[model samples]
Target: MADDHGTSIERARQGRMTSEQIRRRMFDAALATTGTRGMTLGFPGLQMDDVIAAAGVSKSSVYRLWKSRDAFIGELLNEAAATFADQLSDDRALRTAIEIVASRPDLHATADGRRRLILELIRVVLEQNYYSTIDSAAWQSFLATSAALLADDGSESLRRVAETLRRGSDRFVEAMASFHEAMGRLLGFKLRDDFAGGFTLYAVLGSAIVEGLAVRHLSNPAVTDNFYLGPPTLTDEPTEWAPSAIGFLAIYDAFLVVDPDFDPRTIDAYLKELATATGADSVPPADA
Candidate 1:
């Protein structure tokens, strides 16, 4: 039976399987393995034999696809980095933000209420983004690549990884800036006159805070649970505020202020437009 099974496997490989198909299978298997066991610096932990076994491909097939182990690892890292960036769920986050705004009509009536609403949105969104990152293995791998920049190795592989990371970072920052700008306009806020960096800078700072906290959380998960009671101005009752939320709020306040000319009556219309734009109306409830 074992001999028969081996023969069938060999027969399947010799059939019409394409090179791209084989490479994809091996790449996926390697990612799954890295996800479970965690990645090591320089990817030394991802053995070729393990990938072949997991992918159920012959050794010769893999070598035919990638001339050397280094070549395979380099391509894998590049692919992983690109996937991580491509997977950023800004639409989902925007949908959630729309819901937060739509659910609280009373909050839109007054300045304080509007301020509180923005704070709540920031806290919830920050937590949501942070948790999502920690849950994703591809994201963790991409993040790990950041450390590779610290090494003095100027190899072509490292340069590709760095370029991919930069592109991803730029894409993230741009997406975030757009999101923040929309939310700020919806809530009758504008960047302060004294704020020179504008929304782009806001996005950059916000990204740093979330990523910094995420790295810390990896080492001490207790950081997630570490929150202080909110002051009375921000919440009616004492609310637990994560450090990241606090930092974000501080940045938000510094960067934005209430737009005096904003008409509160237009808020509903604004939200409706935002919901339509983000396709949030079709999005199911968070609990659902």
Candidate 2:
């Protein structure tokens, strides 16, 4: 009969979705739900019925994939934590900052010029990171999960979360350290002898400042938008400096000192190499 044939076709279509496919759909739906509703300790707001509706999958399919709701949530959190490092390790902003420095050959000739270049790069990178962080729902959810886990008492889940956070933190620090090392080598600067932890500490502090500002910005956009007029430069009038820029510069000044042994002649070669590495086509020649 036609009715029987149609029912069989519908069943075949539903059967084509493998268990893995169903699980992936549920996972994506859960992340989207958490991102919109915000997560808390134990992910109390993440209901199975809600995820099932959003995923457009049957309750039977989801239940067949996991033993229970708690088991499903555990897997979801584990998967999220596993991906935390990759999600946070974006290098686009750093590459852009490098391009900005490479395009300004005139700034490399003088100590003051180089310092100004560094300041401008920091400001630009920080602003970019802030905007990127706030705009990403996944990043927001990760931050919230981290906060909740860190505030909880000792538990197996807390330990797992802490380890995951440490990995993400380490990746972020390494990215910043690479940025610092490259700038130091190119611009004739080095970590101060008295700075005990070197680039690692510097990276940690910088990340903390940006993360704190981002968290505050969620409640008050004005805090992130606030800027102050910096002192006049030799060739230009005063310019507006963001709060993060001022904070970062203060730390930069305290932690870094000019390298007395650096050779100015090698700057061109360094810039060329840097431009190639960052895939930048607009870097001006050293003489220009």
Candidate 3:
């Protein structure tokens, strides 16, 4: 059987886009490449020839937009950062990042396909120093692309994103540590390091777990002492006690992409109540 990723990229050529359209096509190719290849050979080593081959674009055509392989790849990474900004209200980089994801041909390929692509994008952003290495022109292009994703979203959003991106490079290192720890816990493997590389680590961690999830990621991870971050542990079931589906409710409201009838404020209220009642820090564990 064809891997779901292969089928999707094969179908991307249906649209006969122009130079501008082809630029869009290249972004789609990047997403597809990551979806199929994973990170090791996927992110840093994805050469111009690979993109040209995958994008089915001539060298001349690709060159009209990017001067060299580094420029092309840098723009590609910027596009990803912009896509990631979508989940943040005041972030252009993030929104563009999402727009990039939403535009993927593989979006329709399979749920698993999309997830892998999203994860790959994150890994590249953080681990590969994808965003940091770009030149100013590419940075401008990245933000512009991100703005396109927002489509008339106010400028404030982009500024907010710049603020976030402006985070000290060192922060990325701490972030990488947290990411490795979290991934280690979830997957049953430990990262080779405690996430030592600073901004590169931030970009990687933020892209995969935080950026890919965008907002929906927090659905399960948002718990405070009372709020509920993970599965609730309960000890007694004398009467088969039931818990509220607070997490799902947020899924509905926060991501309108999910629920048509979602009401954000109500969901917030419910979360607040849950937090207060359970006491954020010491909710009884299972069997309590």
Off by over 4 Å in 3: 1-17, 36-42, 85-233, 237-288
Task: Show where candidate 2 strays beyond 4 Å.
Answer: 1-22, 34-47, 53-58, 150-155, 232-234
Best by lDDT: 1
Which candidate wins on TM-score?
A: 1
The stretch of ten residues in a row with the least summed lDDT in candidate 2 is 33-42
Q: Over all chains combined, what TM-score does candidate 2 have?
A: 0.83
Tens-place lDDT per residue, model 3, 1-288, is 578877666546533447787798788787566543222211565766777777776667788888877666656654555443332222222333333333343332343433343343333332222223222233333344444334434545344445444442234444444443332222122223333453344334344433333223225434211222332212112121111223222321232122223332232233234344434422222111
Instruction: Give the per-residue Cα lDDT of candidate 1 at 74.
Output: 81
TM-score of each: 0.85, 0.83, 0.30
Instruction: Please give me the total number of clashing residue pairs in predicted model 1.
Output: 0
Global CA lDDT computed for model 1:
0.78
| Model 3 weakest 10-residue run by lDDT | 234-243
Candidate 2's error at 146, in angstroms?
A: 0.8
RMSD of each: 3.8, 3.1, 20.0
Q: Which ten residues in a row have the lowest lDDT in candidate 1?
A: 279-288
